[model samples]
Target: MGPLRDFRPPRGILVASSITAAAVTYLAALGRLELLTTGNFASSQQVTAGADLQVANLRPAAEQQQQQHQQHQQQAHQQQQPSGIDTGLALSRLEFEKAGAYPQVTSQRAAAGIDDGVVAPQQQQQQQQRLVFEEKLQELASAADREDEVAHSRLLWERRWQQLWPGQAWGSEPKCQEWQASIRPRDFRSTWVEERLRGLPAQSGVEIGACQLRVSMPDNVQMRYVDKSADAEFLKSQCFAKDGAQRPDIVDDATRLALIEDESFDLLVAAHVLEHMQDVLGTLRHWLRVVKKGGLVFLALPDLCDFKYPFGDRLRLVATPAHFVEEFQDQNASRRNFEGHVLEQGVSVAGIDSLRAASGLPALNRTGNLEDLESITRNFVAMNADADRLTTKMTVPLNLAYSTMEHFGSYCEDHPHNVHFHLWTRNSMHGMLSAATELFRPLGLTFVVEELHTAGRTEYNMQELRVALRRTG
Candidate 1:
């Protein structure tokens, strides 16, 4: 009965005595169960450091025998045994079975805050906190993946856009920098119109071709409307309409503005007007002449590649600074320019079949009117006869036929038509203006570029290229 000595008993008592010795040794390693004979509980360091280290290393192998031990304990607990059965051995084995559930040793399990099959309160709380942390980490990784996808898609779109429209990469040339009036380019929309007008030290201004009053004028300023063909009846019949029923104050050629005195107005406003003029530079000179010194000339014109809502001239090649200068040189460029516009309109807007029928050619008339369409399509065959001989296409094909330019020139002169005479973009327009200063300098016409703004796509793709100039001389 000593704690450390082996005792031999009778054959029936031998089994109980051996079982008791094994149970006591196992519990002692746990540093929990006390030995009554030893008078003290086993110390943790003593079990780990002593020669009984083999007992501490038996957990994995012991767990495999747990089921057999559990069955034996159940039978022992239910049935009554003889006095020599050693009840302490059965109870100790049951306690060891319950505590051995942890994957590691009993002492290590206690330090880690785990117990039996049920986790300790502290350990359960830590597991829940770990789960929450793992969930948050997964969410952050998912968000990062989504952001990466968006960034990659955006980069692809930008590259595709750059390939499609090369002209979009404008306003960055060394010379263009000289014309840069703003630290950052501003959107020159209708809303921007009023804000600029209010800031001007202007009282008198004339709005040429004020078809649609896109912006409200300042109450302090006196505004006058002047259109080339402002007959209300004529305007109503045209494809475009005016803002309201208000008529123009003066009806005259916007390019000439003959009635308007030199240096008479403080400001001249023209929206969708400058592109129609034949002599781009000369027209600008005339506009400058009409405005007083320190006067503002505000212009809003459409870009040639206005993909949104384009006109008949959308397909035409953008007129370059050199082309504009060439036009400025020709004294009678108006007649040819007008004829070009009529041909472009007849084919693009009025349709090739409509033009053929309007001209009494062997084709069905699709458009209702003949007289108006005829004027545009008249001499279409004669001007493009070479093209007809070259190509047998049924469509009324048109090309830049300089050999027949004289034929259409005479026709357009006698029978006038409304069309866009010039096609330009923001960059080309800036280049044209830059060229104009040098070309017109000898002509005693000098002006300073006050501002340049490019409006983003609005009203379904219609972009505006606006410019403000102050007449210096």
Candidate 2:
């Protein structure tokens, strides 16, 4: 072929060429593409040939070059494998793609008013500087994210302080000092089982909503997993149960436990289940009734202040013992209680009501009825929108208010079983249990907190509060 002049590459070839160029910078970061000292890649002859170069032709040249390189240095033979090739730079294909998306060197050269295909030394330097700037920007962004996480944690800690001691300013009390010092984060699971339950003459026990048994029972104990239904199909149909979740041994109401005889079991376990109960006192009484005297009732629940539940429980104050007492007195669901939960959790009221109506159940309206769907939908939309705008409650905008309303709506609609009726802290749980013991004393059933494991921290960053109550009646 005569000396090619003004030869323009095919579109496919140009795209492949740009990809190859980008790949060099990309692989260089991984220390895959080594620098060729000969500088033949950008030479005048190669530049002329670049216009008509095919991918097939390019691969052979690269292979030949690598073979020659291996022959020249046997020491680098092992390190120069195509699979493990490293270019000794920290660039990614995406970075290259984003920097110019396909930084065509020929186009760049022409833009800089260069007739020759080779880039000027000054232009090369500028390109290197740009890459360095991008890397530095990434590092700065990562550091800022870390700082934001720490600041948010501190803010939540401050909010927790306010919830515990309402109207009391942060860092202004001796109680706060004492509380901060007393936080010794730990996992209390083994402590309760080893100390309280191991040596006991416990024979049989039942666990409510036992997807996977939380605690390890003694070898002699026969533990039965319990849920609303024993049928696999029914369990799968429920919103909470994941695929292959443990099937329940007994089908019964969680609050009543009508099938389980009074004072029949030696032990009772309910992990992450109590919060779903509408009447906390009634549930406790039922739980106490099932377990024989001196038998332990193990309870584990999420802490209200935990960072894990930022959507709802973390935002609202812990439900007081008095509030629970009222719930116990009135077994029916109240509008105020439902409304507060919906707003705090960013859940949809229409979703809840729709499900309730579909199931032939009465509306959760002791006060707030579903007279107007538009108004209720508006309330849901408005609350979440305001939260996203104002609060640090959401680190990433999940669009739960508008776009993702369907998701939260479906959550309420599909799974009408339970939501967190009450959020608890260590102190709040203790107070409630203490009040429950006295209030239910007339029924000839009582229990005392045997061991409380509200540890400072656990593997989950924060441990849920677990309490072992021993039946005394």
TM-score of each: 0.47, 0.49
Best by TM-score: 2
Model 1 misplaced stretches (Cα beyond 4 Å): 1-189, 199-202, 242-245, 310-312, 336-338, 346-367, 370-417
lDDT score of model 2? 0.47
Model-by-model lDDT, in order? 0.46, 0.47
Minimum summed lDDT over a 10-residue window in model 1 is located at: 1-10
**Model 2 Cα lDDT, one tens digit per residue, 264-326:** 888888877786666788888898999999788988776654432213334334566776677
Q: Write the per-residue lDDT of candidate 1 for residues 1-473, one digit (tens) a residue.
A: 00000000001011110123343454443333322111122332432232134334455656446446556656977775422112222233333344432111123234345544567766755454333333322332342334332222212111112111111111111122223243223343445656766765648888776554433577757888786566776653331332333367888777788988899888888776686577778788888888998888988776544332222223334556775776688776554455455443332332322233323344322243323424323323232332222211111112212222232223333333244556566677878999999987887778988877666544222455778999887
Instruction: Provide the lDDT at 274 for model 1.
Output: 80
